[model samples]
Target: MLCIGFDVGGTNARGCLMEFTDATAPPRQLAEVKERIRDTRAPSQVAAVMADIATRLVEQEGVDPAQIESAGVGIAGQLDKTGNTVVGAPNLGWTNVPFKSVLVESLAGAGFTPPVRIVNDLAANVWGEFCVGAARGHQDVLAVYVGTGVGGGVIAAGKLYGGHGGKAGEIGHSKVVPHGAPCGCGQRGCVEAYVGGRRLEERLTQDYRAGRSLGLRPYLPVELRDVDHMHMDAIIRPDVADAAAAAGELYADGLWSYVADLLAMAIANGAMVLNPGLILLGGGVLRNTKELSRRVVERIPSYILRAAADDIEIRFGELGDDAGVYGAALLARG
Candidate 1:
């Protein structure tokens, strides 16, 4: 039976049809599709948009809707499993929205009654890794995903650990600095301040403003006239670039250093008291993890028990962005 996996991101919803084969048989990628949405604040509208896409996929792909064994949807926000509602999603301005019901109803409307599973995006990513990606065959693992925002998940003995209230893997909100830069979460110095895409742009934007004040950097070139603050916003002054790059590099280093330290602290303090066999790191930040991983791995030994650190292997995520979808499909299959 074919399973459908859907990744409901902030701006786009992606769907893929996949079939799991033997351990050696490569997973077949049957069909893939994407749908973009404006992400208006209305939860009903969001649900409608997702429903429309799922409906179209069924029609265009020639896949039997009823033959789809299961469907998994991954969302970014606080999920109330008991209520099946998206309790809060700051990015989409959603609150108490019945996302699961909406998906079920939408699929039912299209004449298919397959079970649908909904989970947090990071959790899905971890699920994907645990099933087929970096953490495959491992009983204990930590999957850290650094994208526009940072997120993480933990798997203990092959089962996902969804803590009380399901807020387990919210490392993005973990405070790195007290009273530091403001975050979209209305807090100061959250990890997002230093590493999120929006936050990275903010840093460069601030640098541009500073250089403008000092009259040391040229204004945007004619070609950059149409560019927004984010695109083409790096500190361009040769001297400024050097200084800013130094600062940016420091800021990046400091943030990751703090992340590594805090992660180690969490492990030392009890998160890893059991000593996970592998620490699998994935996400956009891990895209350039050579230096960061080395730094973290080097410092971790100082924080944790030597024996525990010795057995830990830190590696990059191989599934890339599909971790969520693949994992979600696994969720639906289960």
Candidate 2:
């Protein structure tokens, strides 16, 4: 069966087409595409963007829209029990919106009326990793994805731990600083405010301007290299790493250390609560900042009880950005 999965975020919708045979067998990827939304913050606009992508994929791949058996949608927000209404998505400016219905309506013209399975973006990312990527073979896992904003997911007893209202892994909203940076979630000092790619970049620029000279001026954005918020790679990848790979290593050490500590604090608290079998790390932040990843991994063991943390294994996401798309597709198919 041919199925589609979409990992919808604040700025982009990453989708993949896959062929499914059996649950244990690896599905074949038929096609993949990333569509940027002009007005991702608007729910209607996001739906239109998804429609555009779906229509294009079906047309380009020459796949009959009617033949598409299922579709998976991973949203980066709080989802209701039905997984249809988005309770809150500050980044997407969505509240109490029936996202699946809107997207389905938009795709009506394409004749793709297959069932859409919706899950949280972070949850999909974790689930994808747990199923076929880094956290595979682990019955219990904790996944932390740090990108534009920080968020997490959990797999307990071999199932997604969505908790009440399907909002179990709202770890980004976990308070890390006291009266610190403001978050889009209307909270202060949340983990994302301190460690997420966007806010972290802002803080880094401020810190760099205040403390030291720009030793790596060429690597920074003309406006501190974070002008484009659509892609984390555009701002955080080569720019952050290239800048910090050299002299800026000394200059940026403090910022990376700060991010590492915040992540450790949040993850350690999760460890204490769940004591998951495997701790999975994902998102562009880890891909862009190797040293930061190392620092975070190094610190996790020290933060939790030795017995709990000792056997816990931390691994980077092997599937990159596409993890959630596959997860959604698989979920839809499964």
Tell me the alpha-carbon RMSD of every candidate: 4.9, 4.6
C-alpha TM-scores of all predictions: 0.80, 0.86
How many clashes in each structure?
0, 1
Residue clash pairs of candidate 2: 221-225
Give model 1 RMSD, 1 decimal: 4.9
lDDT of each residue in 114-198, candidate 1, tens digit only:
8788888888888888888878878988766666677788788888877788877776676766787787788887766665655
Off by over 4 Å in 1: 23-26, 39-41, 208-274, 288-290
Pick by TM-score: which candidate is best? 2
Model 1 scores a C-alpha lDDT of 0.67
lDDT over C-alpha atoms for residue 238 of model 1: 24
Tens digits of per-residue lDDT for model 2, 1-334: 8888897876778778888776644567888778886455577777777777777778778988888888889887788998889988766877899887888887775677888888888888887887777888899998888887888999999999999768888788899889987997787989988888888767655545554524444566566544433322332333464347534465566666777898899999988899899988887877777778888999999999988888899988888877888788777766
Clashes of 2: 1
